[model samples]
Target: MKKLLNYFFQGLLVVIPISVTIVVIYKIIFWIDGLLPFQLPVKLPGIGEVNIPGLGILTIVVGITIFGYFAKFFVANPFFLLLERLLERTPLLKIIYTSVKDLIEAFVGEKKRFNQPVLVTVNKESQVQRIGFITKNDLTEIGISNQKLAVYLPFSYGFNGQLVIVPSENVEKINASGTEMMKFVISGGVTEVD
Candidate 1:
């Protein structure tokens, strides 16, 4: 009974992730297809009049590609800059826009702040250590850049993390990819890498 139950659960663990992924993708595609404003009766210019169920998803793809291309090529730089300026002028919009922009840039932009994984000595005297990523090397903005650095320590078994400002002397940069570090931390140290 124990062996059979173990095998059953092992199979379930393998199948559940794949099943959930497929279901979620299917639902998202369905939702996007359902966003069609109206059925095309006659032929249109770019796309001919066809009641294609997946056309909404296709349109979304095309729109996002065009926007990304424009943004990448700086074709929409002036417009975006103007919009940012306008938002910065407003107190509420400034906070919201800047926070969103900074978070996105930190994760996805050229300067990926979380890529620099390191081993931090939390308490130098007792040698309490922790693994984290260097978030900020330059603390000049906060007026403490002499020997201080900001590190983000991700929690085990959770998505949340804590950011701590520690002295640069206490941090030892590690030679590990961000994804590897994240996976190890998320798995609660179950996963190992040589």
Candidate 2:
């Protein structure tokens, strides 16, 4: 009886979050669809209104595909270069364009180093420590050399609350998978493998 109760509660934990996420996403899409003046014709002959779900996501995909197709051929062409020069001459548009372009490139670029994971020490004593990933490496004349690693320590509940840099020797690289490590952290040390 106790085992069955535990299984029921575990199923509830999984189902509730997934259902809530889908409902929230659907509501947001409905709200955005309300903002647009466009409407799809009713599916049935006499139906009043019919709306498609996830149209916003489809629109984003189509836009990105078109932009990528254009960018691939025009990025290095002389005509496109001239247009880019003209756009850069504008003060306000130049700033906004550069900012957005850089942000998108950082998100989609191959050289983005922040997503690369690395192990780091959290506290002074090695016994009580947590897993973290490297965010940046500092190489400065006044302070630490180029060898220092900055790590972002994520909290158990969600997201990050602490950031620190530890020397290379203090960190012990583990052979566990990232998903396994995340499970350990999310369980607040209740789950671990020998």
Candidate 3:
């Protein structure tokens, strides 16, 4: 029963924030859509005229973009600082929150950590290589040798991954874009890189 309760808390820690975010975004989209006064119907190439919630969607999208700009320029820093301070007061919650936050930020934040995709030689004897992103090129700050790098090897069909410290010489930078490489890795190499 204790183990089950532990699992429940872990699930809540992961699910609640994501669920709340989705719900909030859903509410915001519909609320803004309701405020828009006009709908433009346009003729398509093949099909008849279709009513696109054109301006409402556009307004929401543009509004979100502008909001993001302002958030980055003026609001987000202080807001997140305060939020992180509050989260730090709680022990377990702080770990979960920061981990999830950093993971999200790694992909979409201003400081994208997964941009440098590379092929890591995991087993030299078998000539086995794994696709990963170089998250930290210099691990010296963490007392790791500067000759090693931190590579994040994403698992197939999952958001979770393993981080490995490999010698810089064994890491080969790939020509593919981050998104393409991520897609290929997540699809278990089934997806073609374009």
- Models ranked on TM-score: 1, 2, 3
Highest TM-score: which candidate?
1
Q: Cα RMSD (Å) between model 1 and the true structure?
A: 5.0
Instruction: Give one digit per residue, the lDDT tens place, for model 1 in 1-194.
Output: 99999999999999997999899888897788777675425577999775655667878899888988878888457888798799988999999998887878878878788898899999989999988999888898879876899999999989889999999999998898987887888878888855
| Best of the two (1, 2) by lDDT | 1
What's the C-alpha lDDT at position 131 in model 3?
96
For residues 42-117, what per-residue lDDT tens digits would candidate 2 score against the true structure?
Answer: 4756776666766655665687899989989888989889888887889998998876766465446654434544
| Candidate 2 segments whose C-alpha is farther than 4 A from its true place | 1-7, 31-44, 77-107, 126-128, 141-143, 156-163, 174-194
Candidate 3 lDDT over 129-191, as tens digits, reads 999999988888999999999999999989889999999999999998999999999989988
What's the true lDDT of residue 17 in model 1? 78
Q: How much is 32 displaced in model 1, in angstroms?
A: 6.8
- Whole-model alpha-carbon lDDT for candidate 3: 0.88
In the predicted model 3, the residue pairs found to clash are none
Q: Which is better, 1 or 3, measured by lDDT? A: 3
Q: What local lDDT score does residue 8 receive in model 1, on the 0 to 100 scale?
A: 100
Model 1 compared with the native: what TM-score? 0.73
